[model samples]
Target: MTRLKQLRFEVFGVFFRQCTVDHARQLGLVGWVRNTEHDTVVGVAQGPEAGIADMRHWLREVGSPQSSIASAQFDETDIAELEHESFGVRRR
Candidate 1:
């Protein structure tokens, strides 16, 4: 089953948001990621289980080499539908 997940990343430094977008798109995941007002990176992703897991791995382990990720939190739900066609970065 496909899964939809909302993820929050505590990233220090710059460009992690862009890295998130790049990684998601590369994984063929559909979702949106953006920087929050409180200085956190947040997003939602939907895709096959393996792709989703890969994305999570990227976020947790290889997120922008220029930035430091303090924590990554993910909330996942099994889904019967997908709401996004492609992954992109949003400005908050």
Candidate 2:
């Protein structure tokens, strides 16, 4: 089953967006990631359940080199198909 998950995470680091996009692409997941004004990163990721799980772990425990993860929250629901074609970075 596929899933569409709302990803809201906080990190005390840089290369956050690059790391996220790279990981998502590597997992064959599609989503957009954006930097928030409050130093938080908000985005959505859609892909297979297994891939999603791996991404979640990377976001929560492991991020870019020297990146410190604060917290990660997800609100997800199963979907019949994916809604995005590629993962990209969004501007504020």
Candidate 3:
């Protein structure tokens, strides 16, 4: 079974796009993370059950190095297939 998880999160303290992308890829997800013009980070991740769990953990602890995540919301849905192999930082 495959799934698509959409996460809407806010970075308050200090977060960069590169670290965000690396974290998602390490979690074995496919999609992209981008810094919104509003200063929040929005991302979509698609992968297995445990993989997605890793991503969630990462998001929750993203600020230890220098970033502070104010809040995050994750919504999961069934997707027939994923459009990519691994998560990334999207231009859009």
Candidate 4:
């Protein structure tokens, strides 16, 4: 848990914003997720390397039960500490 990372991601599909928030929190990540005007779910997740990897898999493969995920994109960076204090959903 010493290694931390930050990743910005966009997930295409529906009913994924809250799902993302729950998953991120479960992974002990700290970041925010929101729905875009384009109807995509977008957010940043920062946490341990392993948790990040798990989250990546979840976002890319397994999302909300009702969601029909078409695709996902991610841009990651190495970080020394978390930029967010907790994982959540944002209005913006």
Candidate lDDT scores, in order, read: 0.75, 0.78, 0.69, 0.91
Give one digit per residue, the lDDT tens place, for model 3 in 1-35: 45555444555444667787777777767887788
lDDT score for residue 13 of model 4: 74
Query: Which residue window of length 10 is worst by lDDT in model 2?
Result: 1-10
Residue 13, candidate 3: C-alpha displacement in angstroms:
5.2
**What TM-score would you give candidate 3 relative to the actual structure?**
0.76
The digit string of per-residue lDDT tens for model 1 on 1-92 reads 44555443444433588888888888888888888776678888888778788888887777887867777777777777778888898777
lDDT of 1 at 64: 86
The best candidate by lDDT is: 4
Task: Give the C-alpha lDDT of model 4.
Answer: 0.91
Angstrom error of the Cα, residue 80, model 3: value is 2.2
Query: What lDDT score is found at residue 91 in candidate 4?
Result: 98
Candidate 2 lDDT over 1-37, as tens digits, reads: 3445444444444448888999989998998998888
Evaluate residue 25 in candidate 1 and report its C-alpha lDDT on the 0 to 100 scale: 86
Tell me the TM-score of each prediction against the true structure. Answer: 0.83, 0.84, 0.76, 0.95
Best by TM-score: 4
Model 4 misplaced stretches (Cα beyond 4 Å): none
After the best TM-score superposition of candidate 4, give how far the Cα of residue 75 lies from its true spot, in angstroms. 0.2
How many clashes in each candidate? 0, 0, 2, 0
